[model samples]
Target: MAPPGDSDSSGKKSVVVTALDGVINVNALFTIAIFVGLSLASPGQRSLNSKESCQPGILTVKQLVIFEVLSFSFFLFSSLVAQAIKLSLNLLSSEELAHGFSVVVNEKILKAGMLMTAISSVMGCLFLMISMLNVIEIKTGMLFCGAKSTIISVTFLIVLVVSGLLVYISAAWYAFTHARVHFHRQRTGL
Candidate 1:
């Protein structure tokens, strides 16, 4: 076998590497950045005494900070796990490293990691949707109360949707990588 990330006779990079790169860079990194932004935006000890304070289904700043932290941890771990699996696969393809490593072990790890990533992505989607709703509620309340501006709410909504999309893409990418690895293993009778 040429290995998971190795180029074929055509000299093109393996699909696994390409897909993993896209997921890690475009999707995973973007999602992490969004969470960091959310955490930073948290009002901390500051209370919501503004006009939009009465909005329903809106989480307090403290709650938001906690939520963002959990989410950030989830995606960050998922990204690292995926990277580790990729690296292991690469190592397994190398003659020197393959001596003691079994493809079956790698497959099990990849499968488990993919499942975890998928679950995390689903949770992230739900979180983003909830945040979106909260943003809309705040925006609507502020507009009705004749607040100074809706820019913050609008921006948050945009970010939530964009982050949700990126997380979804990352999940799909993880699934694709899982499938590719499985196919390779099966084909080689590993």
Candidate 2:
């Protein structure tokens, strides 16, 4: 993978690189951008005295709240999925099934995990877009509400689903191939 912020020769920016490149250190950037925004716009803080004291701009406050909530939710969900994947992979590696059966099981679990992750990512992106639309000007909101954004969102969702299915198929194929090899070895006592 390219280092964060390093452009490839083709001049296309890698998502990994862009995501990693912080305007400041990662921790500080997230704190300032995410946590603070959440605290400021949290529904719990929307009281008479608190609202009077803060008096944040309506659109800005709404936008901040939307982004903060969506980001935090995504982070939590992703972490849980990652932990589950790790645990599943460990178990699959250690378990004893028929050689072919074991491979098939592991591959299916991996593919399922990947599909879950892709689904989570797509949902997160869709939520973010909806939140943005909620806070934008009328004209801007109208534009996004048009077929363009709808088409783009649908396209991305389709891609995510298809890619996930491909991963699953590949994993199953690997497992089947390995099992065949193991069966042959066992039969030959090699």
Candidate 3:
């Protein structure tokens, strides 16, 4: 009998590698966006004191800076974690290096790391959204008092909802596809 991952014909390794690569890519992209966000927020925040902030439900420059910084920090942490996971995966997945080193990535640790990265990425996105809202408020006007501001805010919300649904559907499709294949194999006693 073959041990786990001994079956060279299986697609699990490729899928995992692909996922790892995707995570790394996403972290890098988020990091770049975080830097851009900081640049945008910092100037506005520095120019205005708390007393001068626009009133009545509008976000301040300080708030935008805070959210952007939080997003930046989360993305930075996620990038570091993803890099570590990538390094471990490279070592473990390689035939020559797999035995040369005493280090082994525990499955639980790997799962935890993945979960951490996923959560961090999501949090970073949430923070970015808040920052964007603040940005639009500042860039447009205060009090949601203008037609441009109203339209921009409403359109942004609509786009966010649509994109979220798209992501959910895509993830569900992938998950159910895998489950369906597993069910077929079990039913056939493979």
Candidate 4:
């Protein structure tokens, strides 16, 4: 059995691992959404080009493909790293393997993997957002103005997406700041 301090540390590490596992699941859903977006855009793009690659709307389709592919790549990479971290943690947690792995090494690996996965997940969302805008543009019209209705609808969607992103960022900022402050106070016995 671990001492009190070690128990606390292990508990915190377990919490982090659980959080990362949840993130991997969420990212998987986003990965599926990426494919869905591609399928939605594919019909229109195929009708437009299908051959003459130099077509006008084809370029937009290409850009959409680029963004979607990027989103998929980033999310996939994050998932891969999360899996690797889980594997490493599991291996190190075993009594036989635990002797060879230092706590510091495990901590460093967890922190690095968590940081990379977080960054990649955020980037993937950004790319997915951009691809979504492209989908809106493709379905609605060219140069963002097929009609007044299309313009208004796209505007509304953009506002919602941007607002959602702001909310997410704000929440993350608040959560991290409060958590750190609480930890500091606890450590200082304040």
Candidate 5:
């Protein structure tokens, strides 16, 4: 059997699936980049440095940051796994092993990976939003110094929150819809 996109008559792969894969790829790449950026910009254990020197809620900020990092780490892992599965599927396009046990197994694995990725992405988004809120609280509670910096930081946090939400929704919707479409096609040979 030909791969999903190889022949139009096969109808094995819907456009939604293809578009979902593309969106997943883009979001996965962006998430990896965010992780790298966060790692590089991490302030380390500075929050623990002398309570007198730190803000009142510095401890909470530290905890939120840790939580955000962990959630994003899980999201990154899931996204990578999903992307790797998609890559493997693409690599096998030229092979003649399309209608075997392996094909069905791989398809199932891909769907599972996508589902996990969607879940993880949503969790990451929630964690990140909490982290952003913590940052906002910390900023607002600070003295009247660095107002410009606070504004800039708040703007950046809002942007991140909005973008993360968009990614989460898109990823989840794509994963679920693609899975349903795949199931329907398989059942009815559409």
Candidate 6:
């Protein structure tokens, strides 16, 4: 037969285990949202002319490459941070259970995830803006006459603005979904 306190102790442990599982699941969902936002906003389609071959006044492929590298590095770093938070929460939950203590029900984890998502979204927007500017600059440089240059610049500007709006809408949708999940968890006491 088990000791008097063992059964109650095991029951409490199971509750803690369940709560930890909930937290981990929530964190994973948030991470997935960030990845999806990055993919949507990435500049994979914009390739610049080679630096050596590009005209003296035009944007070069080398510059575009540098920008892409920087954007990717930021995305990677944000991802790592998100993963670290998830791991930390998991570890904390485990420690609490082992010590026979209850974990706090604060929304800190959810807020951290939301902040990370917002940062990633903004980074994605910045990359998109840079790419759009490069495109406009190249188009303007290729036009020979002043009037033609102005027309090309205006046209590219309109296109870029429309595209940027679309990207924002998509990012907003992802964030809304994430927030909904977090709210659901809070409501359910999970």
Using lDDT as the measure, the top candidate is 4
lDDT of 1 at 90: 65
Q: Of models 1 and 3, which has the larger TM-score?
A: 3
In model 2, the clashing pairs are: none
Candidate 6 per-residue lDDT, tens place, 114-170, comes to 466446645644554455444443433322333455456657766875686578668
lDDT of 2 by residue, 15-113 (tens): 212322321133233334456435455333332222233333466557757665775576446445645655544444332432433222244554455
Q: Can you write out model 5's per-residue Cα lDDT over 27-108, one digit (the tens) per residue?
A: 5665664454344333432322234444434465565557667666766766676667556555444244443423332456
lDDT of 3 by residue, 34-65 (tens): 66755655443322213344432323767877
lDDT of 1: 0.52
Higher lDDT: candidate 1 or 5? 5
- What 10-residue stretch in candidate 5 is worst by lDDT? 181-190
The 10 consecutive residues of candidate 1 with the worst lDDT sum are 5-14
TM-score rank, highest first? 4, 3, 1, 5, 6, 2
Best by TM-score: 4
- Model 5 ranges with Cα > 4 A deviation: 1-6, 9-54, 95-107, 142-190
Clash count, candidate 3: 0
* Model 5 / residue 169 / CA error / Å: 5.0
lDDT of each: 0.52, 0.42, 0.60, 0.67, 0.54, 0.46
Question: CA lDDT of 159 in candidate 5?
Answer: 88
lDDT of 5 at 118: 66
